[model samples]
Target: MTTNPTLVLGGTGKTGRRVAHRLADLDVPVRLGSRAGTPPFDWTDPAGWDPVLAGVGAVYLTYQPDLAAPGGAEVVAAFARRAAAHDVRRIVLLSGRGEPEAEHAEAAVRAAGVPCTVLRASWFQQNFSESHLVDPVRAGVVALPVGDVPEPFVDADDIADVAVAALSGDGHAGQLYELTGPRALTFAEAVAGIAAATGRDVRFTTVTTEAYAARLAAEGVPNAVAGLLTYLFTEVLDGRNAHVADGVEQVLGRPARDFAGYAAATAVTGVWKP
Candidate 1:
């Protein structure tokens, strides 16, 4: 535990919230950085970041929407410079695997002169249980623009544990950890696992990008969000990240959780039932 509180940007988000909980469990103080948090930290509004950075010893940096969005590197670099100015001792950035923009953001953080660790993770297994896929899973059919490209979907819990270690311990600075599950699975295979765990009839189906976009528009999703989803499903899922990584074991000395475990655990929570 650093003497001062660790600031968790995107504190209410998937991995950020889990990291905050783990740090708190270890008796570390945490300041949440979100739109609803005190001294709200919004990526679009950097002028308000000083208060959030004050007296903070470290930061778990994650961008809203995504770090892969346009201007992401510039924004992250600017914030990193401010963090350096504030004398923040450490930074652990949540990044994405195989994303050029995410890598650029990592480079920016390294250039900021702060001791930092980068976690470049594959897709999260929690997407089915905690995000937009939840509804589709509940509805018993997950339609997407992706096909046979497999992704090594990592557990958010594993990522959280690694982030906590980097934040609270030493020997992690200047390291880039590529976090992934033990194996890769296509979206269909993942959904099949969910179906087996939940004893439900959830299925995955592929659709044309145009059809998916139309569905998003009909559901009232904003055009920007729809575009991001399309890009992720199409460009990012082009089999570029279909391999497993051992960063979880490298950092925490344990194997990363499998998607089956995630689905089984989440199934017990009754979230997959309609």
Candidate 2:
């Protein structure tokens, strides 16, 4: 590993935090890049990025909101350029699977002339336990605009492990890892698994995109956030990435964790308790 610390952007977020912890466990020095971090790294404030990149060997680059958001490609491109200018050894990006905008961002990262590894990950299993679905799951009903389309929800821990390996080890440069779970499950099936694990009565229901959008607007959700959810459900959740990918096993030499495993393990934390 390089003598310089690895800079983890979005360090307080789901995957970023996990990556930072894994790096620390491996005795790889880590520099967190967040608004609350030392020197404070904010994507909106590129002028303040230099301090965070100083002496950094590698970067775990994840954009806030999402790389699919508007202007994200430009921001990532600028940041990548800065990283290259600093002579950073590697960049491991946390990207969404089957999103065109994310592809643009990936292209921008590669264009920067830095050694880059892209982890194009499927939907996260943690979405049920740690994201907007948690409240609905606890309330016994998880409704969304998605139908029976199956998704291979990747574990955040797996993503972090692959990221740490790329950041600290070699042979990962210029690679694009399509990370997903071992199998695909529909939303209803996933909820059923969670219910079984927690002994709860959680159920999944499907709503029209219009109804979901109206609900979000009524609940005071910002347009951008509501729009992102709509895009994911309507555009990205159309069976395009339903198949499983071998990135996890290819990178970590172990099979990806199954959804049932994630649900069972998360149940022990009482995060889904009503």
**TM-score for each predicted model, relative to the true structure:** 0.98, 0.98
* Model 2: lDDT of residue 101: 99
For model 2, where is the 10-residue window of minimal lDDT? 1-10
Go through the candidates in order and give each one's C-alpha lDDT: 0.93, 0.93
Compose the digit string of candidate 2's lDDT tens values, residues 1-274. 4569999998988899999999898888989999999989999898999999999999999997999999989999999999999999889999999999999999999999999999999999999988878989999998899999999999999999999888888899999999999999999999999999999888999999999999889989899999998999999999999999999999999999999999999999999888
lDDT of 1 by residue, 1-274 (tens): 3579999998998999999999999999999999999888899898999999999999999987888888889999999999999999999999999888888889988999999999999999998988889999999999999999999999999999999999999899999999999999999999999999999898899999999999999999988888888988899999999989999999999899999999999999998889
lDDT of 2: 0.93
What is the TM-score (0 to 1) of candidate 2?
A: 0.98
Model 1 residue 6 CA deviation in Å: 0.3
